[model samples]
Target: MTEESSDFKFNYFFGLVNLVAVFLIVWFLWYIFMNPNTVMKLYTPMYGFSLIVVFLSGIILMAKVLKWPAWYNRLFQKDKPITKGILLTIIAFLLMIGLNYIVFWGFIGKFGIAYFSPDSIVASGGIGAEPFVARENASTAIVYFFTAFLWMALFWDLGFGRWPWQNDTYGVQAWSKLFAILFFVVLFYILLFHSHVCYLFYPAQDKAAVTPWWEELAGTGSAFFSLGLILCTLVWIVFSDLLWEGKPWNRYEVDGESTFGKGFVVFFSTLTFGIILIFILLMIFNYVWMEPFVGGQYTDGPDWRYIHAGEIAGFFILAAFIWKNYFNNFPNLDSLWLRALIRSIIAVVLGLLIYWFYYSPLATFFLAKVEGFAQPGDTPLVWALLFLSIILVQSEFFDGWPLKRKK
Candidate 1:
C-alpha cells in the first residue's frame, strides 16, 4: 500500500482495537463496582485506577501512536513510537492518579461543592451508601468533570474552530485556544450557577429536604450538577461524529475554516436538531411504551430514564454514522449520497438495537448481578459518557494540541 493508505490502515486497526478495549474496561468496571456484595472490595481504588488507565491510554495513543502534533516529541526526546507511547503512558498514569486523588477526594469531597452535595447523592440512588462514591458525589463528580472538559475541548474549542483561532498570528493560535477554554469555563460557571436555563430541564425541588448548601443556592444544586452531566452527553452526541469524521451537514467550506457567523449557525443548528430529534424519540417511547404501562398517568416532569435512553440512542446513531463516513470498512459505492443514505439507515438500526439491548439484556444482567444498582438510572450512562469523553479528548485535543494543520 502507499504511505497514506498504510497510515490509514494502521489508524483504523488501532481505532477498532481501542474501541473494543474501552468497551471491555467499561463493562468490567461496571460489573465489579456496581455489584453491591463485592463493590466495597475495590470500589474507591478501582474507580480512580480505571480512569487513570483510560485517560493515559488515550493521551498516549494520540500523542505517540498518531503523532499528529510535533510537540509530543519533546516528552521523552524519543524517536521510536513504542518508546514514546510507553513513557508518556507511564507519566500520564502517575499524574492523573495523583490529580484524581487530590481533586476528587481531598478537595471536592471534603468541601462538598459542585457535584458532591450530600442530599443530591441520595436522591439519585446512592452509590455504596458512602459519601464519596454516592451519586453526584466525589467519584462521580470527577468522572463527570473529565467528560465535561472533553466536551468543552472538543466541541467548542477544536471542532468549532475556536482553537487555533483563524484570525490570530502564527504564534498566537495556541494562546487563543487557551483563552477559548477559559471562556468555556466561564460559560459553564454561568450556566451552572448564574442562569435558570438548566433548571428548565432538571427542575429544582423544594428546599425542605435539601442540604443547607443546596437551599442557599435556591435548590438548584442537583439541577446544576445534573445539567453538566446531561449537557456533556448531549454535546457529545451532537458533535462527536460530525466534528471528527462525518459530513451530514456542510458546516464549513474547508476543514478548520469557519467564521463566527458560519460557526454559530452550524453549532446552534446541529445542537437544536439533535435536541429536537431526541425529544421526539423520547416522546414516542413515552407514549408507546411508558404511558401504557403506567395507566396513562405519565407526568410531564423530567423522566431521567427516558432522557438517558435518548442520549444513548443519539450516541449510537452518531457512532454508526461516523463508522460509515470516516471508516467505511465496508464495500465502497460510487455514489456518495447513496453511501450516506445507507449509513443513515445503519444509524437508525444501530440506535434501536442499542436501546433494546441496554434496556433489556444489559439491564437484566446488572440488576441480577448487582444489588442496589439502578439499571434505569444515570450511572450506566455516566460511565458510557466518560468513555466517549476520553475518545474526544484524544481525538480533538491531544491529537492536534499546540498545532493546527495548514491547508
Candidate 2:
C-alpha cells in the first residue's frame, strides 16, 4: 500500500473514534441526570442546576450586562475565562445550598412560613424514608413570579435596548420604564394570581374541581400553576430570544427614536405573538408525546413529562446557540445556511443517540452501581426552569460563556 493511502486510512479511523467518544460522553451525562438515586442524593438535580443557573444569572446581570458598578465588576469578573467559569459555578452551588438550608429550611420552614416540609406519607413511601419537601405558599408563589419577571425583563426588555430606562437621562424615559413595569405586573398578576380566568372556560378535570380557588390559583403543587410558570419561562427561552427578534413589529427602537406609543405597540404585539407560539408548541407536545405515554388524565395532572421535554428542548437550542456563537460555527467552511443545516443534522443525530441510550439497559446498569436516595414518580421539573433561566442569563447577560459574544 502507498504511504499516502495508509495516512488517509489512519486519519479516517481517528476521526471515527473521536466521534464515538463524543457520543459516549453525551449519553453518560444524560444517564446520570435520569438516575433517580443521583437526583435524590444531591439535593436533586433540580436544586443543583437551579443553584448554578441562578448564581450565574445574578452575577452576569449585575456585573457584566448591566455594569452596575465598578466594585460589582471587580468582585465577579476574572481575566481568565476558565478560572472565572469554574469559580462562579462553585460559589453559586455552595451559596444556593447554604441559603436554602438557612433561609428556606431554618427560618421560613421553621418559623416565618411553611416553605419546606418533611415528606408526607403520600410523597414519601413511609415515615423514615421521607425526603425534604419544598412546600409552596402564596408568598413563595409571589416571589417566584417576581423572579420570573426579572428574568424576562433582563432578556426581553432591557437586553434588547428597549424602553423606560434603556437610555433615560433626567427622568424623561422614566415613564416608559414605569409603564413597562406596571404592564408586566398586571399581566403576570392575572396569569399567576387569577389563573382561573383562563381555565374557567375549560372543563374542570383532575384537581381543579375539588381544589379551592386560592389553592388552584397560588398553589405550586397545582398542575395548572406549574404549567403556567413553565409556559411563561418558555416565553423567555424559546420565544423571546429565538422567534420574537427581527420581526417587523420589533423594529421600533427605544433610544429617543421611537415614541412611547410605538414602543407600547411593539411590546404588546411581540408579546401576543410569543404567547400564541407557546400555545401551539404545548398543544403539539401534549397531544403527541405526553398524552400517549402518560394517559390523558395524568398528562393533564402535573404535566411534568411535557415540562421535562421542554427543558430538554431548551437545552438543545442552547447547545446550538453555543455552537454557533461561542465556537463561530465550527468547520467554518460553508455558507450560513449550509452551516446551520449541518449543525442541525448533528444535533438531531446526537439527540436520537441520547434517547436510545437513556432507554437502553446501560442506564439501568449505571443506576444500579450508584446508591443514592430514590423517589418514585418524582421528576426534576425545576431543573428545566433553571436551565432556561441560566441560558437567558448567559445569552442575554453574559452573551455566552468563555467569551462574551452577543447572540
Model 2, CA-based lDDT: 0.41
Kindly report which residue pairs in candidate 2 clash with one another. 164-177
Query: Which regions of candidate 1 deviate over 4 angstroms?
Result: 1-6, 10-70, 73-81, 88-99, 104-147, 157-159, 162-172, 192-256, 291-301, 310-335, 362-378, 386-407
Candidate 1, 156-265: lDDT as tens digits: 43245533356665346555555565477455544443233222223332231233233233222333333333443444344334322335434553564745555565
Q: Tell me, by TM-score, which candidate is best.
A: 1
Per-model TM values vs. the true structure: 0.61, 0.53
lDDT of 2 by residue, 81-152 (tens): 445544454555565556455554566446643323222212323322224323222223333444444444
What is the number of residue pairs that collide in model 2? 1
RMSD of 2: 10.0
C-alpha lDDT values of all predictions: 0.44, 0.41
lDDT for 230 in candidate 1 is: 42
